[model samples]
Target: MQIQKINLGAEPSGIGGDSARTSNGKVNTNFDAVVAEFADVRASIPSVTSDLGQSTTIAISQKLFTDTLMSQFNDIGVQGALGFGTGITNKLPTGMSQMQGTAIKGHENWGNYQYSDGSVMVYVPRFYYRWGHVNSPNYAKYGVNALDVKSIYDFVDVVAANAAGYALHRAFYDDGQIKDGFFVDKYQCSNNAGKASSIKNGIPLSSSSANAPFSGLTGAPANTLAGAIDAAKTRGSAFFATTIFIQRALSLLSMAHAQAATSSAACAWYDATGVNNFPKGNNNNALRDVNDTAVLYEGTGYLTAGKTGSAQPFAKTTHNGQYSGVADLNGNMWEVALGLTQTAGSFYVLRTSAKASALTSGATLATDAWGTAAMTASYDSLGASYGELTGVVRNFAIGSTTNQVFSTANSGLAWSASCAGIPQLGGAGGTNAYGNDRFYDNRIEHLCPIVGGNWSYGAYAGVWAVHCYFSRTNGDHHFGVRAALYSV
Candidate 1:
């Protein structure tokens, strides 16, 4: 047990060659130069753990001097834990790659947009149908399980008048397999289902022969409105099936604006009594299923013949409530858009051609003779103009001033605050009391555009309702077509 050599430096240990201080000189605590600098930091700990696990090149220059001292002490390092680093042996400084090209392309919902006149626009949001159709298999049993929808189902072959243009041309031209293989027209509404060889009564005329004589000269991607805007431009690029602007049909009626308070006053009709906006025997516009089924459809009204009343299914009609993402819109039936018109004293518009060169200088762009010299590209009713309104108002009257109407007058076509001057809106089962009012009048030529509102007008089937009094060659059962796309 021989341990004794506490010298504490500055010298005096074996006593007297230097200073170790004491004898009132008082100076200690250098425990042998802190035990020889803790034995030289425990012999440089395995060479600083093998230079931080072989990051060598002297651990990348001591990790770039410990990331510049952790970015000037605590700004955190490794560029916030590995984010930037590419090419030129990366140590990243600016390279979001391009030209110095190290491969750095990033964008998530990338649809592409640039136009400020620099022109580039591409947008393909899942091929935008805005949330209209797409569920199919004839929607299980003709869809609408919004939960249960009171059981009973047949839906009178799914509410005719072109079954919302045959379920929006079978969710994108006969069961959209990417718009049925890059589109070659597959709209089918009556070529087989209710067969007559093609009895033109559900008239949207695509003609597989049989009585085909509505003569907008026969062509049927889904039958007119220029074959549902050429099958909604095959799901992209300015496609249209009648949303002829009015602020793009009130941005699709503020996406079913809160079912205008309980589906706009309800009405599958049955003497909807007192009618203070037609609430009487309400069904909140049919089709339920929040927990199980049956939200209101006590029957007696698909015009009675076998009663298909409560309606609401297909895509499960979701105004601004519940099913939210755009569906039946307001009641089901009646959607007809394609350019918009009102004629006389000014309101005409035939658009496209980049919306008539972007309007405003007495607004031009019409031509192609602007209809009537046998207008081509589908639709002719013997041509007076079917590119969108020419004339021939005959029985439902209101024609003869030369045509092209629907106004709210901001002076020569502007209307939209739910459409001013005329083209009235707001789903009205009966009296959702102007559920959001407006439905203009003062007819002009074959009017056209008759959006949302049918199932017997329970509170006026809304989504900005408008029935410009028939005539784009009129096809009833209630009339339908919805599927739009846009680019540029």
Candidate 2:
């Protein structure tokens, strides 16, 4: 049934030219017309179903109904509304702005999303890639592949399918609903009057004192790592960036760099000579490039440098191009990742709690720390599952000549069997890998993972750089953290 507009244009002329009364026959005809129109309108209205499995007749106008439906789909409180689930919101979150034009070219489709508390987050839309063996001779010995591009989903589906069993896909799920994507802090988290922030020119926070920001919140210990986790949580729907989160970001950046390169041979994280694809950052005190001949930036120093800039042709410090990607991921402060811990020469994923006191005591992990038992069971399953044991890398020897790629023959360093084909785990050696950042680990003590070397690390600062030398209680001024948001 089609409902047309009812046009009651003018009042009927009264009988004998009087405006008050109408003839009985005319009144009856008008009443009949009105009844037919209303009946057609009623038939045109669609039925809607409720969550309780009951169908209800809606009598509101069509525009009103549409507005209500859109509200439900855009509700941020809903599990999948903002993430990978239903619909993307046109309304930007507070302090956020969408990137346009060349800034979002290729696989670099993302937006700057800021939290209410001033944490600048970059929205990393979900992308898929297949693991392919590393082609560069510098990285071939490590026996891992680079992340090859498969597909990137820019427009999310209403009923989005879960990305199950894929690398780093577990972090995209929150409470069983698959998220469209996640947000990472654009800069290393800074101290904003004791709260965790990701703003430019803010002082980066790192301290072993019990007075750290967000300390004692939710009964977490006063240590920097625990405080960082609590501080992020206090920002609402946020957590300290986890190893999975960092790994996923790196994977996306790797795929972006590969997709933009002129030759497939350049698809690896680094170029032919092992110079890393991502920016070298402020690793050197002079802010020079890998060759030490060109000055990368003219900033005062690492402590007071701006968060975002273009030191080179692209953003030398950001994960993407100039001012378009996440910043300070190479050589800034060392960002600590939660959920990654190493002890007795094996790495384990910590999923349950972020409380330092409960998880660790001095350099030793508490016996009952969560997820330890399952990770210890099988070696093959280590790199397969989320929150399971990931791969293990043999320690690199200290010194200039020894700080190159992991060579099974020369350096006696090797990646565990489970790490095969994983991107960013192993790559080329020497200058091609960006200062050939060395991976440091200690087999004896319980250690947390700190990635992205600090200033003065020179060739030792990069996206793949990993350091497992610090305990939860030990903190240095160079140690920092980044926050990530899921399902928001």
Give RMSD to native, each candidate. 26.0, 15.5
lDDT of 1 by residue, 105-133 (tens): 11211112222211111121111111212
lDDT of 2 by residue, 89-130 (tens): 354544455444212222232255556666767655544333
Best by TM-score: 2
TM accuracy, model 1 = 0.23
Question: At residue 102, what lDDT does model 1 achieve?
Answer: 15
Clashing residue pairs in all predictions, respectively, total 32, 16
Ten contiguous residues with the weakest lDDT in model 2: 76-85
* Candidate 2 Cα misplacement greater than 4 A, ranges: 1-110, 133-146, 152-177, 208-223, 255-259, 263-276, 288-314, 343-346, 350-394, 397-435
